[model samples]
Target: MGSAWKQLPEELTGPARSLAEELRTLKDAAGLSLSELATRTHYSRASWERWLNGKRVITEQALDALIGAVECDGPALRALWQQAVAGPSGAEAGAQDTAAEADADADAPRVAGVQDTAEPVEVLPAGEPEPATAWWRRPAPLLACAAVVALVLVLVGLRATRHDDPSTPVADPGTSSAPVTVPAKPVSSDPTCQAMGCAHKNPKDTGCGKDARTLQSDVIGKVVIYLRYSQKCQAVWAAINEGQPQDYATITSSTGESEQALIHYGYDNYSLMLSAADPAVTFQVCGHQPEGNLCIAPMSDPAGMVASTPIPVGPASPPPGVGGTASPTADATASPSAAPTAVS
Candidate 1:
């Protein structure tokens, strides 16, 4: 068999001729018969013969496989492929000759045209192309988005203002108004009477004492008790001892009227009926005994009190005429007293 390595014709025209020559060279270098090369490359023997004989166009995949099998330099083969792709076909020899002549005589600068071979021109850099911006950095689009947000805020503000009462005027900082004067209601002596009458009053009065006075007492304190059906109420009480150290006290159902009560004895007769279903569970607050005896007062259910109603819980007014404005009197009138404690 003749060596597949044939010199490439100088007049080789298009890619078909170049590919055929390259394939022939690859087969020659592999030192394999056409059938053997075909088996290795998976191309049929007839197909390989036709491709190497310049009778048919060859695919780049086939050329690549042949190059890989032969271990040939790929860059050189690629350059040859490019040249063949740019060349005119054998049938267009006259046109190719004319193009060659024109290209050779191109001393003057030529206008841009499809076939202009101005040394394979590169795309212009568009005079330092503008840098790409982040999505948020675009001024027009960003401003539009900000305007939309501002519009939404303005609409929400307008809706809010519409719901507000228009008749209420904004208070002026410097304007002075007349002071609110809440008329003083006469303090009842009933609380004082109960404290003195209760017989279970601890001799030491530690159990039932002056701390059990009515809401009329000038004491300021809050007592919170957590109670369970079976468990004893845990009373956490705190009060200012401004006047004589007011002793702390608590009276429960367990403490009979005769027992010495700490704060107030009047609250002992009634038990707090805290309903598990009540939105706000009601607790009882009592007064100190020395000031007032067992006073049954229904306190706001602090467990879940929503602070909708204001209940005052202390002295009627500042002791007679104590100087600078007295504290507002607490509203301590609501009592759930069914069986009032009898003064002994």
Candidate 2:
């Protein structure tokens, strides 16, 4: 952890650099120690160090692992990572090609205009043979080629380390709460227990029902409001979804049960799962390490829902950009109407 804690300090430009930075940020948001990450992912700590160094391009496998482990938006991160890996190298190659062509135009002699019917003349010194035509043999083109080669070598060197050790293997859903049919056996699979009163159970367990969907919160900083409807239990509860490193959201029912979740994967929106709460409920979103916990509570809703029109919320705003105060009946915070008496 000593040297691993320190990030790569070299000045890297383009996609590799950006990808490296995002990977480090993802690790931070996950809150897992390097040793723990090594254990969970079955990857060596040294391998992670290389991955974060910005010298080598991360493969799809590593990228997938980071996405799944952190519960991030996979498509979004994959797009960014692809840009970083392909962006710089392709750009540099194109740039070099353009520069070499430009140098040839500037350095080589050219005719003003010659028609295909006219014969071109080749001028050569009395004792000189034709020069080598290899593009890299020229001064300007050679320099450009050298630069490209150096970069390729650096990237290759980083990846070559992987071949040096072949032990690590890498490989790599939000929607709504709707009425679910209760199976006679009530087979619980992937239940997300998110509230204070809700028992945290595995989605695979036979407790929390299967219905899941994410609702948008209408606010300055887009908040994530997750809804879970359990048919077997015949109850529904809402939980705050978070993914940023600092910000969080929570809700408390009139019965005093509260559920909270931290932001995830540098995402403005996060996912949360909770068992339904008793009575009416209220919610609050807050930030971390501030002098005080400045939390904003959204409108509370009756356990039994009312006929209210859905007020759609947009992509969440960063916590600092948020405005206005939380309201008890704010359209942004929609509460669920119902829950089963017992999850079993």
Give the TM-scores of the predictions, in the order they appear: 0.23, 0.30
lDDT of 1 by residue, 3-35 (tens): 623333333433435455555545543456654
Residues 1-344, model 2: lDDT tens digits: 11233444343444456567667655644555554454333233333554565434454544654554553445656665655544534223211223333454345322111111232111112443223222212124554455455545544543454345454221110433321221122233443344443443322133342332222122222333333334333333333322223555454444455555443322222223344444354444343322334444444442333224332221111111134422222321121111111110
Query: What's model 1's overall lDDT?
Result: 0.31
Best by TM-score: 2
Top lDDT model: 2
Model 1 lowest lDDT segment of ten? 335-344
CA deviation > 4 Å runs, candidate 2: 1-247, 263-272, 277-279, 288-292, 302-307, 311-344
